[model samples]
Target: MIEEMGQQSLFNILISLMVLIAVWWSVQSIRFDLFLKDPEGIKAKGFMVVLTLALTYLVTSFILNYLNWSQTLRFLF
Candidate 1:
């Protein structure tokens, strides 16, 4: 089913969710005192989350051709 949607649409949707997750995760982390001392830590955490999600999507897709869990991100975004 995913293969029928065209790759560019899927790619855009994936990247957008990755970015949104980055923001949400970063805020949650900050709320938990993960970076209590330095205010700048929030920004850093957000960037890391975005990069992590993007890398995760790429690595998972590359290693597992049968996986199609990327759509879960769409609901969250």
Candidate 2:
């Protein structure tokens, strides 16, 4: 049980890191300075980015738990 818990935690961390990197890459690809000139618009964009990351994590975690994909992988290994 302890090993399973550890494996799940590690998987979650790996997924979170991947999601964060993807978000960072997306943000970097966008020309925010050219489009969002207004201070309020910039702030809103920042908030939206944070919200998007949170939602991504929540949705991915929910799907992972529901599917139990990690267990399947463990079995295969």
Candidate 3:
């Protein structure tokens, strides 16, 4: 039982990291120059990092919830 829990935790970590990287990649093309006074500054970069983390959290939660819901469908019959 403990081993299964550890495996599940590891799976979640891997999935979250994958999603985070994907979100970061997808965010790189945005036009932050239009909004920030200094798009190339540290503050702008920090904002981007925060935005990526927030997006990743939301996306990962949704995906994990969907997977759990689907797994529960086995009881529908």
Model 3's TM-score against the true structure = 0.95
Candidate 1 at residue 62, lDDT? 56
By summed lDDT, the worst window of 10 consecutive residues in model 2 runs over: 31-40
Stretch of 10 with least lDDT, candidate 3? 4-13
> How would you encode candidate 3's per-residue C-alpha lDDT over 1-77 as one tens digit per residue?
99999998998999999999999999999999999999999999999999999999999999999998999999999
Rank ordering of all candidates by lDDT, starting from the highest = 3, 2, 1
Per-candidate TM vs. native? 0.33, 0.54, 0.95
RMSD of 1: 9.5
Candidate 2 ranges beyond 4 A from true positions: 39-45, 48-52, 62-77
Clashing pairs in model 3?
none
lDDT winner: 3
Q: Pick the candidate with the highest TM-score.
A: 3
Q: Which segments of model 1 are wrong by more than 4 Å?
A: 1-40, 66-77
Candidate with better TM-score, 1 vs 3: 3
lDDT digits (tens) for residues 35-77 of candidate 1: 4455457776676666567666765455344344564566786
Q: Candidate 3 — which residues are off by over 4 angstroms?
A: none
For candidate 2, give the lDDT of residue 5: 100
> Distance from true position, residue 45, model 1, in Å?
0.4
